[model samples]
Target chain A: MSTADNPIAVLVELRDGAVARPTLEALTLARSLGTPVAVWLGTEPDADAVAQLGEFGAAEVRVAAIGAEARYPAKAGAAIAAATEDASLLLVVSTFLNKEIVTRLAVTTGAGVVVDAAGVEFVDGEVEAFQTVFAATWNVRTRIAGKAIVGVRPNTTTASAAEAPGAASIVPISVQLPATRETVTAVEPVAQIEGVPLAEAPVVVSGGRGTGGDYALVTELAELLGGAVGASRDATDEGWISHEHMVGQTGTTVTPALYVACGISGAVHHRGGMQASGTIVAINMDPDAPIFEICDFGVVGSLFDVLPQAIEAVKAHRGA
Target chain B: MRILVTVKFTPDLQSQRSFTDGTVTRTADDGSMNELDENAVEAALQLVEAAGEGEVYALTVGGADAVAAVRKALQLGANHAIHVNDDAVAGSDVFGTAAVLAAAIRKVHDENPLDLVITGMAALDGLTSMLPTALAAELDWSQLTLASSLEVGDGNATIVRHLPDAHETVTAPLPAVVSVTDELNKPRYPNFKLIMAARKAEVMQWSLADLGVDAASVGAGASRTTVVDASPRPPRAHQQIVTDTGNGGNALAAFLIEKGLA
Candidate 1:
């Protein structure tokens, strides 16, 4: 295996019968590269997982080089090195643990690595990566030529519904797994917020400081639209919503198909995270709130007053 | 149960960072070394604290000011300190940053080969977060990242790494990489003694050539990532400042009507 091939490799981050939404977006970005392949490690790559990935346009999905372990993130890197052999660049979803794996892979392969990319694309026949930085204060665009790896931020781009039957074949690369002085025997999922992960939800209804702890209207509106609920950092920090539901610089970055903000005064930090949303609808008492700047559709109102009517109208439209 | 951690000196992230005449201004106060870096230092300290008897060493790459960050790690209870500094190493990005740290790690390992190399998931200033990965690559080590929690036992590292909105616990063998997240632990403050000791201790500095790195590969040239256009996002034109009075529900209604939401 030589570096001449230089195909892009996406390190898959899948768990418990589901592919992470970011992985889907990475696969979408991977399509721009000549032939995109994924190195699935830890858990076995299954049919359902492969199917969902296919819909996202992966040209290939390779099995990881190492087995599940009590303490190893190197498997993804090792797997990418083994599977993509000649890949010039590698893309991994940023997690606290896998940074080491990608780092090690970059070292073994001598490739440069970038982390927390808000957007990654093929720019002028070169791979350019974007980072949403400074507490979501600014957007920094960068690229490292020759060989590099990038850890992409979530929800920067929507996964394409385009289908590509990636190579589903699994291969066990022969490599010595590193020795660990520690071990974890069991793992469990954390408690999820009432709303689903905003990145995966096609529709997200978020509130800002303006909501005044009155999610009543937002919930009704979200329920009416069959969407998840979110909050700006101001709302979450103010305890109007949980930290998990907070969407902003330190929180989740979502590019849902539809995002409706209620009572959010829209700080640049909050907008940095949600500006990618396809259709933005805002409802605030102030017509000049920053939320209005990015919103494609808006209604200025006391959420308390307009929400009930809006839900009723939606319900009436659904005939329930 | 001894753990050694590494920290980097970077531009303050929370501060409004602006380059004046191609040089960073100190008008911006020092934020945490970097969130990811803090996460890494915190992770190592946690493991040592959990073990009860082990010592922790925290190292940094930079000028005298970096000692402040190193002292921070010390105040947090790092048992040892190694400051890798010098003029030759200035302006190194991740690759150069990795090289300097690798030398320091080798020296520290010679004293005691660490069971783990913990780093922040990524530096907010670099935003590349490649140091941990690059260092691990240089060391040919295993790694786990975005760790919400990390457990060290049986010569292995197990952690709950965040992916998307969910958290997954993963285990990697020893001599591995552990880059962590701020969600993992709240960093403890340094006591007066450790902070004082950090002041007295010397940080070893290395030049770019001494690290066996090509000057072209680091700093302005070696860095693959470049900022082509940097600008403050234009302020929003529609900054509606609405004060909610107790009876403004009606006012809010009228305002909504004015905006056509009513």
Candidate 2:
């Protein structure tokens, strides 16, 4: 199939009846490759969804329209397969749910999946996916022989408004259903400290073992800056914080605009998760902490002593 | 009841890892069973021990070094081990790996129907977390992934998924695949007796032909994806260090203010 006939498809994910920020970035990335087609799963998007898709340059919006049966993996796979039959490429935000769909799609389509890709480009008529693997230590270029399905890392690109929005026409597509194998019976929201989503937070304030199991200073600083709170594996393992807040190779990988690491020793495991941050600042009492080596600015001091003053300074700056 | 647990032998995470020509530079003797898979082995062992009437089979696919993974599983108390070793299976991606595993599971089910298939959340090397779902799709079975807690009874499996923002309880009928996270259970250490037994126990080996998989459709040539290029990551840039005397915090805050990050 010619590339022109098969447009690049972006799997659109909606939350609270609007396009999620990551989905917008995925749309932006899809438009870079070729004509962008947004694939809406489960329900027909409302007018607002269509406007947002067009703002990101979606020329067409294909709705799979599966009813709410919680057939997350199976239905998602069938929908993506039906939508991207002749598409040049398919893009999805790499979340736990979408990763499963990507795998299933690979099996059903005899295709290959590149997970957690930072970027995608068409090189010499073949799609190349740039992946940062092994704790962000290596940048590998991967290629798929057939139409490629890629799971892009969130926040890899900033979403930009298009000058000439595409005329998006919603087209309903039929899919061959796979047998329902799993269903989400119940969901309980996590009790959060309440700030921006950690993955999308502009600033992240993290504490580690050097905090002496005291997160009071870290939380105060984070809240003062209107940022998210993060913890190291040691802090989480020691019960100082929940696993959900841990930032490391085995935990959540974050790339915020500013990452302020307090009391963290800069272990390789932790570095693997946050090395991609736009700017790094380290605060550690130990002058020889490894984190200082990678920080854009480093402070050799106790977090307990430094955080309070930093919070006050930030407050004063804002007030002034 | 019959159970199958899947394990992968990957390079130790602490070891200096690299890729050669787009493939992992797997060092011999440095590779062992993936740490997360140990949880699956432990979970399987506990389930079989509790029931007292079921057998757990450990399965893995790779070259010669992969036998070490099965041996580790056997040491952890799996009744038998099956190693799918074929030269043609080298460089197979997740889909290819899942295809082989599904075929092997089906071959075993034909002999004695399986009640459950379990795996870890992901392989540390690839970190794709794709095998269980792909296997489910291939076998047309239910998949319950990232379960922090699990229970099996009355022809059904129930799991509690510890998601980032929420906790979800999911249930699926038996003859399903489940992937467990590290928080599920603490893995037990192999006793000396089991260690000795693992060395003496015979490991069954199967080839692509034995599993009825076409080599061309799975191995390097059949691989849907290729590594076009790879290189070592460049070193991080030099950093600016600040010694916090009394004004350190204010200085750091001033920097954030300058960058509009405060």
Candidate 3:
């Protein structure tokens, strides 16, 4: 039985052996709900990572030393379940892998789970999650009946340090991992695109069929803005860009501070993925492109003509 | 090889979706098979076809209108269709739904051992992507999800999962549960003969009692989450459209600078 004062466990994801940015954001969100306890899944974190967690208001760090087996989602989930015995709610960064882990944890603990949540709040001692559904057309609020596990989307909350640093005492816990039938035979790394990840990028510049199988200009503009380069399904289908860079209902859904659609006629499918962006700008040759309907700024012109000029103007402004 | 593929009836992606009484309002006219499940159906068909001596069963759990989902699978060359429909099954969350699915799967497995159970990576409507893992846990079966490519040979199933971080090749023994992504293969359209036959095909219907699923354990009352409120997001405000005349790029840059987003 969890009271209002019970600790909330925030699953800490480590990238390159450091706490990931999204986990920091999750920790920040957890602070308002309850005492934030950072739960690290793998081996012991270094001093810097622990300090970082402490800086974000995690009063204590529960380390589940699952080690190499953490690659298996079930094993990691079990570790979390064991480590978070005193927690009222579990917060995680919503990735596909994390979703699976939290699902297993929810089942094992009989907890209610809501993933891809944009925000969460406590209402009358119950957890309520807010999310956009059906491609950002509707906003839905879900209330968990019992113990809650929320998989929050990346970039939904800003990561801020606490006014006073937390204790950040380290606690190591042991878990009994279940045997699984599935075996990972091999793992091959894929070269990641440069700049920020598409889902977490503050600015996203996407190209479409109008790019004519060329992403040079799109890449250039995105680089100038310190953003990620994205592509429409048509552009990816035409083999102009890899599938990871595709943004649509079937691909990555990004909620960036600024979204620039160049040479793209926004279909409802595409709009569903990015309509929630803070600011939208479109440059299309077609005067009546649907992208213009939702964009805060629309330019009816050739992206080839507009992008280069925009690039130069940005450069001139920065230099000035 | 005997395989079972799970399908879902969902509102068309282009339809106007709404929630009534804290649940998605499903009408017969506005719903069909989930688009992503086509890839699962296609994978099942390909696996059975390659084996040259196996049966493919398409199973769906929903209201009466959900029969459309299995019928769509039948048109795609599935040998059998199963529709598990009961009023008590309404408003079930992913966990409750998984329990119902596992019970139905057990009933089918008892009659004839199933070599594999397959599903889509995620249902387009819910987009939770959690059912496959939940169902696998309920059944205590090996779960191989998000497979971009799958193969079955020598009593084992292998898949290559293309995740954001890495591409992993995983292998599991038979009697596993697999969920495939759209990148696996292009789903084939229904042929004329199969389409005609599927229209008149008899679908096996089962109630909660038939599958021995307790009504109290698998409906709105059993769900752990409840929808508190739902509404359409307001449209964007402050519209600005400009026809670029050489100075368009400068205007875009100026706007970005003003917003402090440059």
> Which candidate gets the maximum TM-score versus the true structure?
3
Write model 1 residue lDDT over A1-320, tens digit each, in one string: 32223457787876544787778788888776655666677656678887776666665566653555513545445556776666767888775455667765666676656677766766776667776555444556666676778887666666776653544444454555655433444555566666556655767888877777878778776766667898987787678777778776456767676777888888866775677665666778887776776765566667776666556555554474
Better of 1 and 3 by DockQ: 3
Residue-level lDDT of model 3, residues A1-320, one tens digit each, is 22325798999987767788889899899987878988997777899999999999988888888887887878888999998888878999888888899888888999999998999999999999999998787899999998999989888999899888765888888889988899999989878777688988889999999999888998998999889999898898899899999887668888888999999999877887788888999999999898998899999999999999999999999999
Q: Per-candidate TM vs. native?
A: 0.72, 0.92, 0.97
The order of the candidates by TM-score, greatest first, is 3, 2, 1
Candidate 3 clashes between residue pairs 3 or more apart in a chain or in different chains: none
Clash count list over all predictions:
45, 0, 0
Local accuracy by lDDT, each model: 0.65, 0.85, 0.90
Candidate 3 lDDT tens digits, B34-89: 98999999998888888888999999999999999999999999999999999999
Candidate 1 residue A19 Cα shift, in angstroms, is: 5.1
Q: Residue by residue across B82-115, what tens digits does model 1's lDDT show?
A: 7765655555556677777877777767777788
Clashes of 2: 0
Q: What's model 2's lDDT at A136?
A: 69
User: Each predicted complex: what DockQ?
Assistant: 0.24, 0.63, 0.79
